[model samples]
Target: MARITYIEHNGTEHVVDVRPGLTVMEGARDNNIPGIDADCGGACACSTCHVYVDPAWVDRLPKKQAVEEDMLDFAYQPDPKRSRLTCQIKVTDAIDGLVVHIPEKQI
Candidate 1:
């Protein structure tokens, strides 16, 4: 399992141990971290799972794919530099201490 941190817009923090092969979205939902709706259930078909990758960990993640980029266009207040759909990010041992910041809203 990888230890990941989720920080909410209002400054709440949730640190969870996420299993490998699961997406970050799953980590939030399974751990009951608020703000990640995952309306499409990690299908990458919706933007409700949007979160901002911590600047320090952004470079360590895989580059965004075209589908994720397109879906992010529907996200509220999307930030190209940091906004990401948690569903697109798979948890792995390599990212043991990953930190993600939740946006103010998701729809």
Candidate 2:
């Protein structure tokens, strides 16, 4: 399992141990973190699971695919350099101490 930290818009932080083979969105949802709505579950079809990867960890994550990039256009307050769909980020040992920040709202 990897140690992941999720920070909310209000600065609330949640640290969780996430198993590999699951998406970061699943890590948030399964741990009961409040910020990721993930309306479409882990299908990568919704922007509700949008999040900003910490600058330090951004380059460590996998590049977004075409489908995830397309959906990010619908994310609230999208930031091309940092915005990402959590459902598109698979948890792995390589990202052991990943950190992500949740936006103020999902809609």
- Tens digit of lDDT per residue, candidate 2, span 1-107? 99999999999999999999998999999999998999998887889999999999878788889998999999999999899999988889999999999999997
lDDT digits (tens) for residues 36-71 of candidate 1: 999999999999999999999989999999999999
**On a 0 to 100 scale, what is the lDDT of residue 21 in model 1?**
98
Model 1 regions lying over 4 Å from their true place = none
Number of clashing residue pairs, candidate 1: 0
lDDT of each candidate versus the true structure: 0.95, 0.92
After superposition, candidate 2 runs with Cα above 4 Å error: none
* Residue 15 accuracy (lDDT) in model 1: 95
- TM-scores for all candidates? 0.98, 0.97
Q: Where does candidate 2 clash, by residue pair? A: none
Model 2 vs. true fold: TM: 0.97
Among all candidates shown, the one with the greatest lDDT = 1
